[model samples]
Target: MTEPLHSGEVDRAEYDVERGKIREFARATFTTDPVHTDRNAAQAAGFTEVPATLTHTVVAGHQREQRKFVEMLGLALERVVVGSVKWTYLRPLSAGDHVVGTRRIVDDVQREGKRGGSMRVVTLETEYVDADGDPVVRLEEVLIERGEQR
Candidate 1:
């Protein structure tokens, strides 16, 4: 059985946006935009530094934090199903930026399954802020934990 769910922060971590990492990610993701890898090019393009691709947050170690979050909640990883994922970009995050991500449990609900078991839906939100505490990005993930068979 899973522990009771609560709506609050679960984890927080600081992520350093390094230039080499941004370049590597840009190459790996086939981001042809020079602004993502070349500082001079980025500067010419009116950016202060190399900017990361929009989906670069996927590699920011949030998955490990989420796994720990599930474990802390006493939920079995095998029984959990991803419902949906959403990302909202508030501002651009560039190399040389130190961003802090705070993860929270925003919603939890119990629902009756069509079959015969109960289901638990949990929504987790992670907010990223720059060094000056300005919002940079927001990520929300919905997970559903299935109950045991009848």
Candidate 2:
């Protein structure tokens, strides 16, 4: 049997934003807001560069880190379901910005179900800071699934 995942902080991961990545995310999320996709539109909008929404930053940074965390735990990705996600933005993230992500396991609990099953809910909180060390966003994600199924 595989060991249970240890609850702790994961190593921080950093990514330098690429123009292509920003454009792709914006397009994929259906964010047609010119300030997010077009450089000229962004400048016209009073931004020196395209600005990404909080959701964009969260998705790009958190998703990769979460997958790595699952791998570190030797857990199957398909066995887990995202129960909830919340993001709080402290500052705007521009297209050319670089971000560092720190993820920590905030809570873990196991419960027995009336149907003779057991489940675990794990809560993880991640903070994203810009190159200047200013916090840009904070995200909380909850994953839940049957304990033994994974």
Candidate 3:
């Protein structure tokens, strides 16, 4: 049996934003913005370095925490449904920024499913802070899990 998940800190991970990674992510996401790939372009735009694509932090290292959270909740992959995802960027993320993200379960709710079994709504929020301890980004995900039908 898996332990019950509470509204608390899950884990923390550090990611080093690399320029190569930024370019690769940009290409993968079909982002043709030169600011994401060329430091010269970014500098011309008044940025000190290449800025990551808007959604870069989503792939920075948050998925590991999400997987761990899912395991802690005793959720099977097949039964886990991602209801929504939201991202909040407090500052521009650029290559060479060392970011530390603290993942936490901010909210958990249990309710009886209208169709059959019980339902659980869990919200996981991760806050990424830079080396100076300034908040850089926040990622939130809502997951809905339903129990086996009776």
Clashes of each: 0, 0, 0
Query: What is the alpha-carbon lDDT of model 1 when measured against the actual structure?
Result: 0.83
Q: So what's the TM-score on candidate 1?
A: 0.84
Candidate 3 local Cα displacement, residue 53, angstroms: 1.3
lDDT of all the models against the reference? 0.83, 0.76, 0.83
lDDT of 3 by residue, 1-150 (tens): 123457688778788888998998999999988999999999999999999888887665644665766687767767779899888999899999999988888877776778767877788898999999999999998988878656
Tell me each candidate's TM-score: 0.84, 0.79, 0.86
Q: Which stretches of candidate 3 lie over 4 Å from their true place?
A: 1-5, 62-67, 113-116
Weakest ten-residue segment in model 3 by summed lDDT: 1-10
Residue range 1-150, candidate 1, lDDT tens digits: 355467788888787888898888888888898898778999999998888888777766743566777788777788899999899999787888898888888888778889879998888898999999999999998989998766
Which portions of model 1 show Cα errors greater than 4 Å?
A: 1-4, 62-67, 114-116
- Residue 70, model 3: lDDT of 63
Provide the lowest-lDDT 10-residue window in model 2.
57-66
Model 2 spans with C-alpha error above 4 angstroms: 1-5, 58-68, 74-76, 114-116, 148-150
